[model samples]
Target: MSYPLRRRLWAAALILGFFVLWEVLCLALQVSDLILPRPSQILATLFSRMDVLWPHILQTLWTTMIGFALGVIVGVVIGALIGTSRIAYDTAYPLLIGFSSIPKVAVVPVLVLWFGAGPLPAVLTALAMCFFPIVVNIATGLASTEPELEDVLKSLGASKMDLLLNVGLPRTMPFFFASLKIAATFAFVGTVLAETVASNKGIGNVMMSASSNFDVPLVFAGLFILAFLGVALYVVFSLIETRFVGWANRKSDFAST
Candidate 1:
């Protein structure tokens, strides 16, 4: 069998084994549905309530994507500035770090206060959550450009913009895409967090309501849906990374093999 297929098969097997073990343990222990519903019960809830859940799922998905896209745009612009200019780096990087260090939970209420408890707050929260990683990666990537290469390009009369367009951005593709995968997950965290606290819709709110009602299975179902969406985003970005930055990654793959 091909190595990639074998690897995927192993992953699928492991996931299936995990669910099977969970089901068996739950059944054997006779775990109460209120405390820890079995996988079977969660799956049943997912199927039964999918119609009701669909709109919320869509809300969360689009909110995260929009926020992630905005984060990428803002991150690239600021990152380019910080990466290319010492003044911007020294002046802005520390503040950026501080803003990122603030717990996103603390920021959600302020967003709600500003935006008044709807999808807008969720979008902004996701944007804030995903912003730092992309900025740091893009800045690092641009800054890491080989000094010798820069000198050579300058000797050849390459302007700064030309160097950035021709060399820096391409070199940063791997780092940028890597950050996307991480930021994608963070985007979800932010959206769900804001949803639970500020909004009346989305999976976070659904889970919150379910918990309040002592519906453990529904809560787990919401968690499963979020996990699925997060994995989907991660996989999408991974494919894009392979498509654009595979040359940069080839060495790592070769070394691993």
Candidate 2:
């Protein structure tokens, strides 16, 4: 009856409908399990291998968290610097674009070379993958500040730093949190890529190992775990955005609706 209950029911129905469709298609086509296992099969594999998967899941979670933390720190500082100054923005924006264009997966090997194949490479890769979006979003937010507002602040005897600290920083919060949602997903991609490339543990390694043995269900299970982790992290950041940036959120949602 309530809107919230209806939304939850609708989401649940969609997910259930998807799994049912998948199962029906697999059965109707007589699909090979190797190519695509059924959802039930995947769930069975996941539960059977719970002991094996738990450690790798924890490994991935901590690596991603560390990398995400590092990314947030670097991204916020660099983003603020570039956003507040026209000179800095002009000089750095192009360079940032160029840097972001490079595939982070390509850097995993180099990280492995330096760090000698462990969690370090995964952490660094995740940090690298996540920082770019945060930088761009924060910078864009700051750069988009109303010129008239800045002029008014200047007329009121506000120094550049004072204007930036008081006005620019608040404007940047919504963008920063929004970017974190995207960057959190990227952090997962980077960590898993690094793990598959050169790590002894993590879900990526488990998937890779399963692939070698032709254990398709296990591979899918690892993928499922990774997807769960990413979604969970995204939800956490979304909650944070709702709490800390509710004013901007309310305005945006109102406009959209």
lDDT of 2 at 192: 97
Give per-residue CA lDDT, model 2, range 1-68, as digits (tens).
Answer: 99989999999999999999998999999999999999889999999999989999999999999999
lDDT (tens digit, per residue) of candidate 1 on 133-217: 9999999999999999999999999999999999999999999999999999999999999999989999999999999999899
Q: RMSD in angstroms, all models?
A: 2.6, 2.8
Number of the top-ranking candidate, with lDDT as the measure: 1
Q: Which residue window of length 10 is worst by lDDT in model 2? A: 248-257
CA RMSD (A), model 2 = 2.8
Best prediction by TM-score: 1
The clash count for each model shown is: 0, 0
Model 2 misplaced regions, further than 4 Å = 2-5, 251-257
**TM-score per candidate:** 0.95, 0.93
Candidate 1, residue 257: Cα displacement in angstroms equals: 20
